[model samples]
Target: MISLEQKHHSLLQEAKRRTQPDIANLRLCFELLALTAAIDRDCAVRLAPHNLSEGKFVVLFLLHGQPHGLSPHELADRAGVTRPTITGLLDGLERDGFLARHSNLQDRRKVSIRLSEKGDATARTLFADHTQWIGTLFGGFSSEERIQFSALLQRVWRNTDAGKMASPAIAGET
Candidate 1:
């Protein structure tokens, strides 16, 4: 079987022949995608046994220290997801008895979310495990290297022009 790196090299070679693409940029992008996919896969595996999706786990993690809980909108913002997505996660969590929604005393329209007893326990365990897992990912790097790597990643993140690109949908797809 061809290794992933070898496959990427073959694909890049084909790309060069077909379009004469910028090899460095394309390789970097491919590497980033591969890294993201690996992290996502690992996270999914880790969360599976606990019956949590990454989004649900993230919500639980964010709610850990909030004594007064968070509004669904606030959770959405902090989680960097849309309100509807957060609502769906919230619905699932609530159904699973992992979280509680409380109405504000002064305003019936306002609802705050907090973890159920079970959620608190699960979050604590997951948080510690998550911290350890994250550390291990960067364990080979020195402190200075980690800082420099973080800075470089932030720079790459800020340099995106993707927001201006047109969607890849066919004209009649919508």
Candidate 2:
């Protein structure tokens, strides 16, 4: 009775032998991971002047377009981080006057987060031409290539648990 780990190792070895796995698949995987890391680093650098980290900026971005304020748990879900992490981000934002937290009037037990006036202004300043920044990253790709790439990315995303983790509801929260 082979263990699961042993079976997986056997399969991987077989794949490497049969495919000579140092080819397109492996190279593409490495390139994609490197590109993602570079993008994240660039975003962090661009946001540093505003005293915001990438995670905090993501929370602000999500709240920017929504009329309904999000609870910390909801923000955590959308940001794909733990509730405690979101709490820390919210605390820092609140202290910096970028956002405010209020107890839900109808349910005093729940706390909702909303952007302060300062936060709104800061977001506007920081996000100017943000879409153009993203466009620059893919500028070399043709329109058809962009569509195909996007569809491929969507397929990969859907096949992973990462997509499920970003659902509107809090993870493991009733």
Candidate 3:
């Protein structure tokens, strides 16, 4: 029996020939998607033994930048998550003793969050380890290739118009 990978390869080959309007850009999109998934999978594997997810890692990483602490609103904006999503992340972090939430002195309505001692150590270690891993992963690429890919990705990012587009699922509702 043909393996799943074989089947996927066949499908992509067929798609290249038969896709509607013969858009060549789909190949680039697929390549980008596969590259993205591989990077995400590798990162997830590296963080797995520590019981860390990308979201948690991002929170810790962001907290490290603002040692004085960040407000939930600030985190939401920076993390590109909804305020409620940040609340969920904070709840887990607080429960894990990775961070603490304190009432903001400047605004009674807002709360500030900062890493605990344990959180700081974990974040720092993970950041260093992951930085090394990232460097190793990209070591094969020459400086020119890296620069070209970065520019290409920036163009694709702008093409998405993500900042201006509404969530696809909710677009009709609004």
**lDDT value, residue 118 of candidate 2:** 82
Ranking by lDDT: 1, 3, 2
Q: Is candidate 1 or candidate 3 better by TM-score?
A: 1
TM-score of each: 0.80, 0.68, 0.75
Question: In order, what lDDT does every prediction score?
Answer: 0.86, 0.76, 0.80
Clashes (candidate 3): 0
Off by over 4 Å in 2: 1-21, 65-68, 105-107, 151-174
Pairs that collide, model 2: none
TM-score of decoy 1: 0.80
- Tens digits of lDDT, candidate 1, 60-172: 99999888999999999999999999999999999998899999999999999999999999999999998899889888999899888877775565456652243444211
RMSD of 2: 8.9
lDDT of 2 by residue, 31-84 (tens): 566668778888888888888998888888877855567988999999999989
RMSD (CA, Å), candidate 3 to true, equals 6.6
| Candidate closer to the true structure by TM-score (higher is better), 1 or 2 | 1
- Native-referenced Cα lDDT, model 3: 0.80
Greater-lDDT candidate between 1 and 3: 1
